[model samples]
Target: MALVIGVVSQKGGVGKSTLARLIACNYAASEWRVKIADMDLAQGTCTSWNRRRLQNEIEPKVAVEQFLNVDDAIKTGEQYDLVVFDGAPHSTRKTLDIADACDLLILPTGVSLDDLEPTIKLAHELKKHGIYPPKISIALTRAGNSDVELAEGMEYVRSSGYHLLDGVIHEKTAIRRASDEGKCATETSFKSINEKVDQLVQAIVNRADELGKK
Candidate 1:
């Protein structure tokens, strides 16, 4: 029973794939047997990222795979401690299918109205499919410490009947640089963003533990 986490959303450029890869790379580096299944065959962004990771020698410790379907992706589920599914944008059917198969669904949205709306709609859609997990959360990415706009976005999410991660990752050049190097934030020398991502991982682990007791 691996703890499967699906990173999903209805919109693109919301950092879904980036979050998935980051989590997978960091968790694996920490000695957790981790696997990442990229379900977005059209873009193959995660898959390509992993490829670059291999070529650049940044993915030495992570096991990443690309799959076109849920069943194929779950084939090695029992072998790993965790499985992360990086989903395609705007694919409700595929997203729901992955939701049904995961222990947790992590919807990553930025601090903006455009990003928030689709996230709320996505939550409702998952509920409608009856595939809602015991733990479904919203994560705030690309945040800024002094930005009043980020605060407004948090207020909006609080009003939407959903839970947001207590730790918000600020928009930093380090994130993009680390990604390009095929390294996770945790593996980079930067501490600010890495610490926040670690907190996000801990929160998910805590929620998954709580769900297991139910």
Candidate 2:
């Protein structure tokens, strides 16, 4: 079975789809048969992004398909080396199902109580549903260049007994602009951002193996 990475968030504009596409883009570039299962059927952000990606002739194409059910999405993953799920921004049975089934569950959020609180609640809810913290990670996304805010966010996530990824996605115009061009922040001219994105990707890939060993 293909390794599944679920990118979930409880609120919109938290970079859920952006994070999913970043990972999927890098994986596809590395020759992994990657597919993004856009779980947000109503929005279809990932699906539409993929169309723009194709139109712009982005390298190492990745497939994006929309699905309403978690099981149906997993079945499609069977044909790929890795499947990245762009989950919806609201609570749903399908969201929990995806969290429980994924090799690694990623909760992307900004560094604030507004983002982390709901995300932590969702994480706790998933824990109650059988997905433990070891299989879940909190990714700091769309963060600004505030050391205090970032430190506080990291500490908050760790104190909640969840893994806080070291490589954070900063709130950069380059990140947003790259995505608009069907590219990832890692593909931009910003070397520091690229390194961070690469680090995050490596950690996630290692996490999949880490969870599998348990």
Candidate 3:
């Protein structure tokens, strides 16, 4: 059976789509049959990115599917080793439905207050609705030099009592270029960022392993 992971956020521009693409590409490169389900039917960000990925001839083996329904997404998950879901900002119901069906849920958010605050609420909501799994995690992205700034946000997240991955993806121009070229984060030659992404992938896989042990 395939491992299903959903990347979601209540607000846009939190890098949920980017995380989905990153996971799909890297997992596929690792020899897993990976597929991405673009649940954002309106934005179609992942869909378009997949097209660009094809144009760039990057990670050709990774498949991308644009899905409008939860049933179809569930079906797609059954066909691959890993399925990464990139959901729309407004599609909470659809996203949660998929979450309920996933083995893990990745809520990618920026370290800034604007992005992190609502995610805290969403986390509670997901738990309340029984859609969040023990494997659910919050990934911090687009981090910058604190000088006390970044640390403040981290403190806030910690104080709020939520699970956050140990790895953080620093802001880099290479990430933008990679997206523009439809390449994965690791393909951008950003070794540091790729290392962080690798840590994230390992963390998730380890979590899944732990879950199966129980």
lDDT (C-alpha, whole model) for all candidates: 0.80, 0.87, 0.79
Pick by lDDT: which candidate is best?
2
Positional deviation of residue 45's Cα in model 2 after best superposition, in angstroms: 0.9
For residues 1-214, write the lDDT of model 3, one tens digit per residue: 7888889888988888888888888778779888898888888988888889888787556888899886787786777888888888977798788778777788888887888889888888888897644667788877776637667767777776776766666678888888899986667777777786677767666765665621
lDDT by residue (95-209, candidate 1, tens digit) is: 9889988887889998887888989888987887786534678888877666698889889888887777676767788888887777765556688668867887777667666
For candidate 3, what is the TM-score?
Answer: 0.91
Best candidate according to TM-score: 2
Query: TM-score of each candidate?
Result: 0.91, 0.95, 0.91
- Name model 2 segments beyond 4 Å from true: none
What TM value does model 1 have? Answer: 0.91
